[model samples]
Target: MKEITIDYALRATWQAVARMYNEEAKQFESTMAVGFTLLSIDPKTGTPSTALGPKMGMEATSLSRILKSIEEKGLIERKPNPADGRGVLIHLTDFGLEKRKDSKDVVMRFNEIVKQAVEAEKLQHFFEVTETINKLIADKKIYVKNTTNH
Candidate 1:
């Protein structure tokens, strides 16, 4: 609509999706962030603490809180990285792996539902638009400094 902006639409849609996931997560006594973090951690080799935040597009403090909660819940454990002595790797517990499977199913179910509801062309366009937005930000082309002397 002419009254709505792209950023607004994106934010609103994401918030709704997050709410949906969180509600579902509540059934398992977990939050969406925890489920997402569970899904992010590799089951076999684990993931570095440093890479987790960037990979998830999460801030350090937010990710830290989520990790702490997950750890307390016995879903994940941190171990010294063999490759890098200074880094810690987050490994999923057996319980964490089970929860991660649940998370993946939930996400896949959402995707399937969306696929059924939306046209393929529209979904393709959505992906293209998102790609363009990401590229613009990555390339620093979304905003430019004013060159003229004020």
Candidate 2:
């Protein structure tokens, strides 16, 4: 039998999930990226434009595109950051807040459905394992043997 790797499984599962969300998003003329971006931003105070990319694990160019689309849709407004003149804060408009709530509901529904289908212990372990994997990669321990700098 052929062996399946963790990376392949993660990528495949994520692709499926993204496709599912994209299908749902079509009804609202949005994409998975936009929905996720909406949820990631702070609805009340606003989020820093610089911070959103890292926070969402998104590349600057891709995030810039999404932000541009979101802004063009009248969902968000970029304002001068009072704390930093050079930085901008991305804030949700009233319409954006409404859409954000909808986005939140979609995410909550997905979680609730998964929770209902899976055992709590299994879910917890899944999270723990994913976290451990993330930590391993973030700390560069996974590639330690290959890197001379380590």
Candidate 3:
């Protein structure tokens, strides 16, 4: 049997969570990406089109595709941005709001179930470990190239 590494564990867990979300979203004729995009947009003020990519940690092309898909489904609309003359803001339509609520409910249920299943201390430790991992990556502590060539 192969030993499990930290990256493998993180990737596997995330894949499972994504698959679960996608399966739930399928009932609404949506995908996980679309639902996530809906949730990311501000419900009231709307979000700048350029900001969505950075906010969601998504690439522009991928975010653009998701935005287009949701727009076609009547889940969102694009409007001229008041703050930026050259930019547009993404707003959720009534249907989008409804779907966002559904997405929120699904996410909340998942968190609630996980909290109920795991001990609080263990959960806190899990959070700490993940945070540390993120910090290390963000700080460029991992994968530093060897200064001396072999």
lDDT for each residue of candidate 3 in 18-131, tens digit (9 for 90 to 100): 999999999988889987898899999999999999999999999998898889999999999998899999999999999999999999999999999999999999999999
* Whole-model lDDT, model 1: 0.94
TM-score per prediction, in order, is 0.94, 0.94, 0.93
Give the local distance difference test score of model 3.
0.94
- Decide which is better by lDDT, 2 or 3: 3
Q: Quote the positional error of residue 65 for candidate 3 in Å.
A: 0.4
lDDT of 1 by residue, 1-150 (tens): 769998999999999999999999999888898889988888899999999999999999999999998899899999999999999999999999999999999999999999999999999999999999999999889797688998
State the C-alpha lDDT per candidate: 0.94, 0.92, 0.94
lDDT-sorted candidate list, best first: 1, 3, 2
Per-residue lDDT of model 2, residues 1-150, tens digit only:
399999999999999999988898888888888999999999989999999999999999999999999999999999999999999999999988988888888888999999999999999999999999999999988887654555
Give the true-structure RMSD of model 3.
1.9
